[model samples]
Target chain A: MNIRIENLTKSYGDQKAVDSISFEVKTGEVLGFLGPNGAGKSTTMKMITHYLNIDAGNITIDGRSVRNTDMKKHIGYLPEHNPLYEDMPVIDYLRFVAELQGVDAVKLDDRVKDMVRLCGLNDEKHKKINELSKGYRQRVGLAQAMIHDPEILILDEPTTGLDPNQIVEIRELIRTLGNSKTVILSTHILPEVEATCDRILIINKGKIVADGTAETLRKTASGSQVLRVKIQAPSQDEVKESVSQLAGVALVEKVEGSENRLEIQSHVDQNVNEAIFRLCVDKNWVLTEMVPFETKLEDIFRDLTMN
Target chain B: MKTSNATWIIAKRELSAFFNSLVAYILLISFLGFTGFFTWLSGNGDVFFRKQADLKVFFMIANWTLFFFIPAVTMRLLAEEKRSGTIELLLTKNVSDRQMVLGKYLSAFLMVLIALAFTIPYYLSVSQLGNFDHGATLSGYLGLILLSSAYIGIGLFASSLTNNQIVAFLLALLLGICFQFIFGVLANGSTGWISELFNTLSLTSHFDSISRGVIDSKDVVYFLSITFLGIFLSEYIISKRK
Candidate 1:
């Protein structure tokens, strides 16, 4: 199901949680929602789910209003906190939610089995929710949210408390889900966005500050241009002389090297590489490689949020 | 999820949670034990209970029984959801506020009904005594069921108001007691419109009407109004939560 959020605004008294934010999630695509704590990420997800009524805005799912309860069949959600009944066993809990999501009774067992496997809860399938670790609990949350196999999954920080291994596992699962489902994943983990999201909506202080693919965001970032170079070990004078001679080299910085590395930046990607390669060869120094450095996701996030 | 489907799911889960835990059993045994013990022990003899088998015994005992017991049962309904952050989980599923309220209310009502059922032996045993008034006993139970439902709804509203179960329990009890007994007394001591309103607001007056085996439309209306109002507030409060 495709989701369209138009000028959605929610305010708590004088403080606005979601300030007229709007975006769309196409079918069979993953849209990463990035924001810091109190950036209204959870609030926005809540509004979309119709949990917290909109103070101002419109949300439609497949042309039907968000107010339509039947439209919920297309959406699944994993809340940030992963709240669950502590006394309940994993399978039982999923089964309960599955029935609620209107899964066919005859296929209930099969559905829950699929969910358990999909969420990697096979080891502790029968354990009480409170008995599991935070990561396992999160997995259960994901399993329940997706037990119905919804077309659109709205996951709120699906990997918040997991260890590295769990994070990777969940990321892979999310990526796999994205291939066949439309997912809007809200997270503070920027790398998760780059890893799993086809596109991103970065909100800051309740407003959509950036909306585009990773490449678009990187190109739009402040330090989007960088030069990756490998050069022969050189005398300090030669290095300083050749680096300074490049006309468009914004900054020449030595990458602490035992391995002939250098990091450079330029506002304009002119003939800087040619200049560096020529200087290395003219000095009879071995120039192994020279290429433009790709902008890191962290750099783009920092620049966007800071600005 | 379909709205009714979601509500039924929550209700079933809640119901199982109630029975699966020690709280339901504790509520049953304690409410039955205390009320039963008081009804029989207060009399001069075992065979006759304070001169009549009328539900004066049931009403009198239940009046205090609900004070402490209903809180224990209703405390965790919404407060647990709030504490565990499951309220967000429920909300994000697109289950409307009324569904949540009713789902939770139904579970608590069923649990209370279970607890109330244990008192059946009391009704049966009372019959063994002097010519027991089954009609009055049944009506007394009807009154209690109505009264307790209204109280439970209030408890649910209180539970919805905060994340602390203890706070919810106390607030519900305070509201229930104020509406049940204190409102009547206070209304009696005063005069005029304020008195009239408070008199109508009291739970005991309506309950007393039902306790007589005479179902008053006015009494039914009052109990139903409070139940609906409490649930409405519960829905509104939950809808406001983030």
Candidate 2:
């Protein structure tokens, strides 16, 4: 299933929580919804899942408006806070959710078993939810959301409480599922998005600030190329002066507390690698290392979301 | 999914939740014990003391006991769900708001029905003791069911108003008191159209008429209307989030 949200808006009394946001998620696409707290990621997911009323906009699933149609069975949602019945056993809760999602009675047991195996809940399937640790509970939450084989999965902080091994396992599961399903997940963890999502969307203050893949975001974030170079030369000052004089080299300065390494910044849309090598060959300065430094996702995220 | 199927699924979960905890057992034993003591063992209103075969004393005592008990049975139905944030999970499923309210309302009503069913022995032994007005006895039970239906509606509506169980219980009781006796009291002190209006609105008048072996459609309508109103208001409150 595909989701198309156009000009969606929600408000709390005098304040607009989601302000005229529009986006689209196609089939077999994993969209990482990145935003700070109160950035309307959860609100948009809720509207798509039919959990909240749209104040002024259209949310259509597969070309059908969600306001007029019931799209819940097609979309599985793990809401923020992962609220669940604390007294219900893990297996029973999964079955309950499957039934609510309209899973056939004949296939109910098979579905529950598949979820337990898929979510690694075989050891604690019979224990009440309250007895499980936070990570196990989070797994239970994921298991229930996917039990009915929904075409679209909306997960809010899906790995909030998991250990490193569990996080990797869940990410693998999501990646496998993304091959055939549409996934919109929100999280504060930046690398998890790059690890799982095909596209990253950064929203701040209820509006979309950036939307593209990790590579494109990096390119747009910092247009200039930076290289860390270490050289064996007669004099560090002579090497720096010679490197700074090369065409396309915007700036060159020695790395602090380093004798032979210098940082070089290139102008926009310029490549100074060949020029630097040619200069080293001409000046008798042996360049030992030259490493291109790409802008990090963290820096891009901060640059876009921060004032 | 079918509406009734969804409603039944939700109601079944709620019923099982009641049984899994101590709430169901405590409610049953206390309800049976309270009604049984007044009907068969009490010195003042005992069947022997009244020299009556009809379960009028049992009906009267049950009417009061259920007024307090139904709120307890219904307090956590929606309130606890809201407090724990599970309402978001439940509502986003294939279930509609009206179906959710009806499902919870049905569960509480079934609990009351089960409690009332236990009192069949009182009717059987009372009939053995003397001549029994089967029609009046049956009508008395019907009156109790109808009365409970109305109270459960009110209790659910109160539960929908807030996330606190205590507030739900108190709000239910406060709303119930008006129909239970305040309207009747106010009617007794007035003598014009307002008195007649209050008299018609009071649940006591309708319940008394039904328990007297008179199956008036007016009384039935009164009870059913209140139940519908409660269910409708709860649905409205829940759907307003959209």
On DockQ, the candidate that comes out on top is: 2
lDDT per residue (tens digit) for residues A1-307 in model 1? 7889999999998999889988888887999998778999988887777677777889998888887766766788887777887899998988888877778999999999998888889999989988999999999989988988888898998998899999999999999989888899898888789998999888999999899999888877744367777777657556755786678777777777545667878755355777777778778888787777787788777767775
lDDT of 1 by residue, B33-67 (tens): 87776777756433354577655766767867986
What's the TM-score of every candidate structure? 0.92, 0.97
- Candidate 2 residue spans exceeding 4 A from truth: A257-259
Error of 1 at A237 (Å): 1.6
How many clashes does each candidate structure show, in the order listed? 0, 1
Native-to-model Cα distance after best TM-score fit, residue B143 in candidate 2, in Å = 0.3
Computed on alpha carbons, the lDDT of every model, listed in order, comes to 0.82, 0.92
- Work out the iRMS of candidate 1: 2.0
DockQ of each: 0.64, 0.79
| Cα lDDT over the full model 1 | 0.82
Query: By DockQ thresholds, what CAPRI class is model 2?
Result: medium
User: Taking the tens digit of each residue's C-alpha lDDT, what string does model 2 give over B1-242?
Assistant: 48898899889899989999999999888888888889888999788898978888898899989998999999999999999999889888888888899999999998998899888888888889888899998998899999999999999999999999999999999999999889999999999999999999899989998988899999999999999999999889888877
